[model samples]
Target: MNEIEKKIVDQFDVAKAWSHVQHLVEKLPGRYTGSDQERQSAEFIAARLREIGIEPQIQPVDSWLGVPDGATMRIEAPEPIDIPCAPDTGRGQLISGEFIVIETPEEARQLAGKLTGKIVVIPYSYSYPITPEEARKQGAAGMIYGNWGPSDVDILRVTAPQTWTYWGLPDPDAFRIGEQEAIPQGHIGRQSYERVRDLCRKGKVTGSFSANIRSFWGKSHQVIADVGPDHLGDDADFMIMAAHHDSWNPGASDDGGGVAVLLEAARVLHGARQSLKRKVRFMFVSGHENGAYATSTWYLDNHWQALREHAICFSFTDNPGFANAPEFKIEANEELMDFALACARDVVGDEPKINVHRANKTADRGFFGVGVPGIYTRGAFTQAQADAWGGAFLGYWNHSNHDTLDKIDPVNLERNARIRLLEAVRLCSAEILPYDFRRTVAGMRERLEGWQADGRYDVSGTLALARKFAEHLDAFYGPAGTRDAARTNETLKALARELSWINYTYKGRYGQDIFGVDLKKPLPIMNSIDELAHHAAGSPMDLMLRARIRRDQNKVEDALRASIALVTSS
Candidate 1:
């Protein structure tokens, strides 16, 4: 690496980085999807990216963060009760009606009597979380739920140090009461639920609910910036370093820390542009907390072709601070599991207990929808802390108003950023790509086997598909040296491994094991590799392509869902 690259890589000032992130916390007023708070946050990021001499762009999004017109609920049995409800960023149609009572979904199923003018209530079950989904399943006009389980608060805190980041409030949206069936709904905690349930038990039970929501169509933005040489030739592939700029919760541990790391890393990279062999693009995205991934979705639609041809994607967000939790872990691109291990070793140096696992099947990477592999670093808290306060990985406070700068520790931010900076630099500057194949293949085979055992799939076709992919994997990695051979070998191997993970792990069987696809897949996965890859040699085109893929992968997901539905039906 040249002097400039060295200096840029070395410029991660912990204190200044923390200050930058701290300042941003005040600007983020609420959930990332809607509200002026989110818009201001996006603008600040764009300004910073522009200051770095990179063209910053804005993207309009349908933030479900609609202005709350109002909502009310009334029960006309025994004693009348009034309840409060709020609009979720993930919007649902307005609904108002009397509530209908059903014993179970099966009972509700048998009594599928017209509910166009009624809300639905089924007794709470031990499986309360899934109960709303069940209610939606039963074709209820809308849901008025009473929980049987405890509702606990989730707390998040981080101790990492880096640049400025915005912390904002969580979306006040209700749970997935409607995503499954476009129904309006509301839930009451266990304590309050008992009163409602007791009243329902009385002979005459009647309830009415109504919601009025005001929403505006506007644009949001995703900012992209770059560093190092502009023309690195077709043979080079960049390692993309990324983070989502918007937040839910003050977003301190959730991503303010991650954003700080990205800015600090970018500052270093921009300062030392000459030594980079490949390009490094920094992406600050919005819409992560709502719309699932509006910004990344937009990027994929616009830039996926480039992603397919020239890049490796990496992303960082969420709590990358304190490491004293049960086990500070790293989720890696399964195909390059060993490669990630090698990089991690370089940064923490023999921290044997830094548990590493396969990617969580989805995150920002899945938006790329292809074989692009990425990682979701483990939350920064210990097991005990996670149990008590909820760790960095989407705790109760994640999108709540609780995500503030006060929850973060400067020391934790500094350590995590330094680790990421080193990782990114190594990847960007390395001569020989370090992505591993055998281990990834092993992981895939294991996954395929599990799917077969589940009997939920027609193993024949999917298994055949898996074998073909494995063959491609073997062919891609066969070449040992020679520039073209090595480049193709490395890139294809990495792509195949990631694609394999995306196809098999992200959706099919592996994803099913982890609830539904509630997470964006591409960006987070890319963030995992961005830090280390940049420290070595990386390609900007590669980074750009990943950004595009991060935006485009949804098509694949849609297709996959269609195909899977067909298979299951057959």
Candidate 2:
């Protein structure tokens, strides 16, 4: 580490950060989006920033928020019973129907027509193959997600309230092209699931499901602060360090830990502002839990021009210091993976390998559309813990009322802060933004080859472009650095932006995808390539699929060519 980085690390006070976490959990619990508590938390974060000599701006953003009131499920047939449950999302309506259990997507497909007017029960999954919207479209009255964890543990006790609305916090002015009717949704524990399932096999089963959720238009707040390079021009490049301030229940680990890290980092970085070559902006966003990243999306919309032009990269933190979490994980876009890992190794020795992954549609990843590469670092559960807990990376306490101050570890929290602080300091002080596009091109080529081997649509054209781009990148970063530092940095930034957009998003640069859906595949725009093989050639469906693939291929090619142009022109 450099002198400035070491100095910044020396100033880290985990006790101070722990105090912030305590305050958020004890004084400001239940920070639901757009609620009074959420606004108060925003003010609290702003006050903390002000205390550190960073003038923070709290911007109010209007959005749709869902607040859970209560939920209940009662079986009325084959033996009357009241099953404990947790509400996901609904409009405060009660409905009763014949109970139907579907264990997998295949079962749902087979019993599609038979599910009309019935309450369907399915296993809860992170990537829902059959979403609530599909159940609603099949004329189902309500949907019940059975907990996927062990039978002994009460999953409902730790599962937080979630929304089934695919398009979380829809655009107020945009029209819903094919919106479906809202359906009541709730979750049941494992033993409850077995009881309901066994009862259904004995005789005709009937149950009532209701969720009292308050849905309305409301306002959330974002606290933003900029430090370093006071005289920099409007278009001057800057790095973003962001974390969500609002969360479910006590949220000490979900984002309370992340907020503590961000605040402490800001305080330390502010002390070394004079040594930074670029500006560092710290952002605390709200509306992550119930609003589904609405506040972050709002910030992106309001500051598109400046962010697209001047934002060098984005680094976000979430659920940083769980008590029992021993695994350190880093998720980043390929371009930033090398630099981020180096930072991780610098702080936590290279002996314990860090688990690295490509960035996904989580955290405050709304910057993907704007072509801003991002990295998220957090302590995670070990494989044994994950397996025993039904594969929950953040443990069952995530987003739950159990996510309290007691779940946080001071030592782990301080380690996380130091790693992130080192990242921020190096990013701010670097001459050329630390980006390696060679990894980016190589990843694209590998994905294209995998698709080609599937014997699906011809990906050769895009694959060739990826190969060519790799060649250009190789020449650009030879043994000795280039003489034109300014041009080199600009070229690297432009390439990173375009390539990141194509690799992660399908809505081009302006639209937002639905929340809670998986879009982690390479070149998401062309993800439908495999579907083309299922249809017969010259059929209408086949023709439509081909046309869509061609269009998406053009998008990929345009981005590759743009990257090549930037590299060659520089």
Candidate 3:
């Protein structure tokens, strides 16, 4: 290891850091998003950053900060069946009708004629959840949904009142149908629904339901923060570290963990300002739990120029406590992969036991859709524990309220924090930044090709557009060094910042109907940016470039396949 790397390893304080993280975790429950508690938590983090010699800024978020008013759901049955339901966040209107039973898509197509004005109950398939858009498109007035399992304990019953999250994406057609202000929806357990289906197959299965849901409530907020070196020169780039601060019931794993990591990062980096060669900025975001609309969209609009200058952003989130369990490799922007892998070596050490994902699935890294590569560091649960509890199979309490800090292991958190800290420091001080354009190109091509292979899209035109975007990336490459470092750094930072804004907006508001062209038409631009991230390390991009290069590249088939992958969950 290099002299600096060896020193960083020596300075890592595992036990002390663990104690500090525990203290922070204990104080987190009081800081649920949108409440005064949340604001207080932000202040505390900012104060800590200041003490470490870094100036912290609070990025204001656009949010509806208040208790969601009345909610309700009801079945206006001729003879009521005792089933439970609740008012989803933003619901409206109430319409009553008899339930129509359909067993297959064929049945749905046939019943479409009569189902338009009636409620519909289709058997729940083992794969895929029932989506509202599909039901609406099929001409159903209301829905009686069924899931794969029985109703587990309803944890929401005990959550602190006045707590709520972003209810899906914003929609003007949104409505509610229930006893209180709730959506007109209900779910029957797997066994109960199967029984209902059998009864319907034998004969008539009819029931009526309605919901009196309320209209839209107050607005929501999105907070942002920008702090870094004032001058790194025009071509000098930056390393961005980010995470969402909001939560779903204290959101310990989904993002509370991420917030804490960023806080500690800012503290350490700000304290070691003299050794830094590149600029560092930290973003403590909100609304990621609700789908990243407010912060992601607003950032794109308000600071498009700044984002274009960002080098790369590292995202920290989820139950870092699972580090002791089976190791899943790091799948990140290829340019950043080596840095991540190196940090893994330094922090994770050599291990024959676990796999690492370099080109892994995307997270907000996917959100950086603009191609600026970023990393999501959340350790998964032990293989045995995960297998025993299917939920744990996906790393436990994903969106559930049980994501408390108590669930985290101090050793796990300390290891995760060290890896993140070293990665950030190493990247900032590296002689050559670590972005890989070729791999990024390959990744985008893969995504496009995957979409077309699914047979659902005719996006050949997008491929042609993608190649053209690749050219823009080729024209932008420049050499890095200390003499030009100051100017080069500023240039890189400006571009990273601007790229961040563009990608944020692009991801948040891509599919929305914008001006005639559907603005998201430029997805390739962001994809190309991710390619540049891969070029960061001094290593030749050629050897590592073939990882995702598909020999059979078909645009139409690839586009369709990519589209389907976006919808179907594994």
Query: Which candidate gets the maximum TM-score versus the true structure?
Result: 2
Candidates, ranked, lDDT = 2, 1, 3
Q: Residue-wise lDDT of candidate 3 within 1-570, one digit each (tens)? A: 567655654555555455445545566564444555556566766776676666666665554232323333343343345444332233445546656666654565455447666666654332222333455665666666443333343322111111121222333433222123222554444445555556566765555443322332333333334444555564545656766665555556545566666666666666565577777767665544433234554555565455555545555454555534556445564445666777767777776233444432222333343335566554555556654443333443444446566666666666677777777777777654555444444455566665556433334565664555455445445332233544444444333333322323333323322111112222332233233233444346523432322212232234324333321221
Of the two candidates 2 and 3, the one with more favorable lDDT, higher being better, is 2
Where model 3 places Cα greater than 4 Å from the true spot, the runs are 9-30, 65-86, 90-130, 142-236, 290-293, 314-316, 323-325, 329-331, 334-339, 350-370, 382-396, 443-570
Better of 1 and 2 by lDDT: 2
For model 3, where is the 10-residue window of minimal lDDT?
A: 157-166
Q: Which candidate would rank higher by TM-score, 1 or 2?
A: 2
Q: Top lDDT: which candidate number?
A: 2
Greater-lDDT candidate between 1 and 3: 1
Give the per-residue lDDT of model 1 (tens digit) for 379-445. Answer: 3545455444312233434444566676666766665665566566666666655665556545545
Please give, for residues 251-354, the per-residue lDDT of candidate 2 as tens digits.
89988999999999899888888888888989898878877677778888788888878888888988888887777899998888999999988888866558
TM-score of 3: 0.64
TM-score of 1: 0.67
Task: State the RMSD for candidate 2.
Answer: 2.7
Query: What shift in Å separates residue 332 of candidate 3 from its native position after superposition?
Result: 3.0
